[model samples]
Target: MELAQRVQSLTPSSTLAITAKAKALKAEGHDVIGLGAGEPDFNTPNHIIEAAKRSMDEGLTKYTPSGGIPALKSAIIDKMQKDQNLTYNQDQVIVTTGAKHALFTLFQVLLNKKDEVIVPAPYWVSYPEQIKLAEGNPIVVQTKEEQQFKLTPEQLEQSITERTKAVIINSPSNPTGMMYSKEELQAIGEICLKHDILIVSDEIYEKLIYTEEKHISIAQLSDSLFNQTIIINGVSKSHSMTGWRIGYALGQAKIIKAMTNLASHSTSNPTSISQYGALAAYNGSDQDIEEMRSAFSDRLEKLYSWIVDIPGIHCEKPKGAFYLFPNVKQAAALCGYDQVDDWVTALLDEEKVALVPGSGFGSPENVRLSYATSLDQLEEAANRIKHFIEKHKG
Candidate 1:
């Protein structure tokens, strides 16, 4: 059977593969401790669940506007004003199936064949694949761990070209969990503005920050940057609503309209019930977010110390998000593996602990472990990792 070239060229999700392998082992009666799943372990908040139930009881289950329900969009608009101090009318926002879907659709509308999107290394696993699917080239610019895995403005300026359509900025980044400060974002935003490149800011982890560092949208830096920027965010991370499938983009009305049209043909609208649930998420109390963020922070602090204490392991403390990315190249060498991926596989096989090899995130010398689980699980996983390294270290 023949498949489309675009589909054929797509890179399979390494995170999902690792997670599935862990699940398979657990099903076979191995005591697998998975540290690869990227979501919070918390259940959806009861109020949001009740809101969905109420919506269903009130017959809000029918088709909504392709972009989203008007009320939900209004909620989103209000959220932007209150949280980020950015103002947007309803026309500038489009809600989609998820932030991932929102990004995919944005690429489809924004990219022409052979055009390029600048992606920083250690990116979310889906970014490059989605760019490929849209017939765009993903130009990966590798960031150094010494610089906290952030793409510098100089690096951004060097990577841009006439074919460059946009650059992705995922603050409180996914695999690395590091954020760019406002000064850094200002510098990068200026570069993008000068080159007339779109600033695609993915703020999915904005509410999960553990440090005093605030998540600032590059779009909010100035009027010029705001006009050229597209903000992609959702309730998935912030509100423990990952399964609800509600994510959105805020940008100029023209791009938002094009994206809404694309979505009308594609997903038709985000789940109607889910939109109502997200409305509650945006308008309701933020107690749930505070609680979840606190849990992740506590886990991150404790687990990071344990991870850094491991022999031959080095990790930068993350400011936000729930993952710990540790440079384990020395550990891999000491354990007699040529690649960190192999070391990750051996750890899972021997110690029944699952971690995502950083090769998938464009950094082969590291590994990403989610502290989204309980402290007990993190402690146990750390002990197992320590033991594994000790047993194999030569």
Candidate 2:
């Protein structure tokens, strides 16, 4: 069978590949410690579980509206108003299968052939692929580690062309966990506004912040920015409901309506049960959120300390998200490997610690490790990594 050309160029996700390898090792009875996962380790809160169960008991298993149930949309709008002080009508919101699907649907509806989306390097792995899948080009602009892996206004300005259609801003960013400040967003937003470029802001990890800095959306900076930005978010990370598969987009009514039409032909609608689960997630007490954040905060603190103390490894303490991205070039060099990817493989084989190499995230000198596991497991993973480096010391 002939494969489609679009998928032929698609690289399998290194994060998922490493995670599967780790699981295979464990099944073979190896004491593998996998840190490549992107989701929280916690179970869905009991209340949320009960809510979904109640809906099932009531036989709410039928299909919902293509976008989402009206009640869920209302709950999402209320959340935006309460949390971000932004108001949106149901017309501007379309609930999808997940935040990832929201992004995919958005690019499909927005981009034209040869259109360009300016993506910052050290980006989430799917951003470029999603853009490409939609027949758009991903213009990756490399961000400096010194700048906390953030794209500067100057960078954004220089990357623009007549073909430039949009730019992505993933705050409390995946892999790096660095966020753009309000001042930074103001400057970048100005450039996008000047060029009539759209903004795609992925704020999935907003609730897991460990810093005093509050999560600020680029849309919140101004009315113009709000009009220009499409916000993608979900309850996966915030409510520990990764399996529930509910996420949404908030933007122009016209675009959201297009997305809704597209979704109707694709999945018909998000699973009815998961929509109810997500509706409950949003409407219930945020005490579940607070408790989960506290646990992640402790894990981040302990794991960050242990990771940085190891020789030849340098990492910036991330303010949000559950992953630590450390530059392992020096460590790889010290371990006698010429490539970071090889170093990662050797660590897994020899020390039984699985990590996601940063090559997949467009930053080859680094590797990402999730601290979403138990403290004891994280501590052991750290110890194993330290031992791997020590044993291979040049």
lDDT of each: 0.93, 0.95
Clash count for each candidate, listed in order shown? 0, 0
> Mind giving the per-residue lDDT tens digits that candidate 1 earns over 114-157?
89999999899999999999999999999998999999999998
Give candidate 1's error at residue 154 in angstroms. Answer: 1.1
Error of 2 at 158 (Å): 0.7
Give every collision pair in model 1. none
The candidate that achieves the highest lDDT relative to the unseen native structure: 2
